[model samples]
Target: MQVDPGDPVEVNIWEAYIRTAVTHAEQDVSLVELERAAFYERCRNAYAVVATGESALYANLIIRKGVVAAG
Candidate 1:
């Protein structure tokens, strides 16, 4: 399930993917861990907010808009 850098993905489809991943995960894992794994798989770096730290469990999921060229 490798996605191209600029591939257009529908919101619903992405949601489903995440849900399925969590549901079928080998062991119980937090949403944060699941998302971070996804970022790593895509070869992308993720920075945690200092304020949130590890306390922010089940936090808001970050969505990448990708690179958009200025017209």
Candidate 2:
């Protein structure tokens, strides 16, 4: 599936958050060989990855309040 880049990329940020719990509160994933759409969907469904990188494989968890507008 071709990720239209319109749906929003999500990610699993628990690990990142764990690492940055007191340091930052965000995580990162290195996806350089995965499909664009697949990466996006994975991130979107992830209850963690709060933020997404320019590509799709890279992502971070956002802390704050509301949902990250994928912007």
Candidate 3:
């Protein structure tokens, strides 16, 4: 499951990664499915930003914002 950032992202490999995450999400089945679809959509429009001199493995990072309350 070691993926180097420089390598091209393959469809099957990406799908496998998504499946693995969904499996261990510990969320309700309905919510998992909803989020899974969102993930797939994000993948469909995904783009890679390759940086020069970046040799670190799995250097990609994802940050999601927490829910904000509407006052």
Best by TM-score: 3
Encode model 2's per-residue lDDT on 1-71: one tens digit a residue: 23345667555444454566556434443224345665566667656653345443434233334445676
Residue 28, candidate 2: Cα error in Å is: 17
Candidate 2 matches the true fold with a TM-score of 0.25
Model 1 spans > 4 angstroms off: 1-10, 28-71
Give the residue spans of candidate 3 off by over 4 A: 1-10, 28-71
Tens digits of per-residue lDDT, candidate 3, 1-71, equal 23434668543444554666679655532212224445546555556534457444343333233456699
lDDT (Cα atoms) of all candidates against the true structure:
0.47, 0.46, 0.45
Q: lDDT: which candidate is best?
A: 1
TM-score computed on alpha carbons, candidate 3: 0.26
Once fitted onto the true fold, the runs of candidate 2 whose alpha carbons sit more than 4 angstroms away are 1-32, 52-71
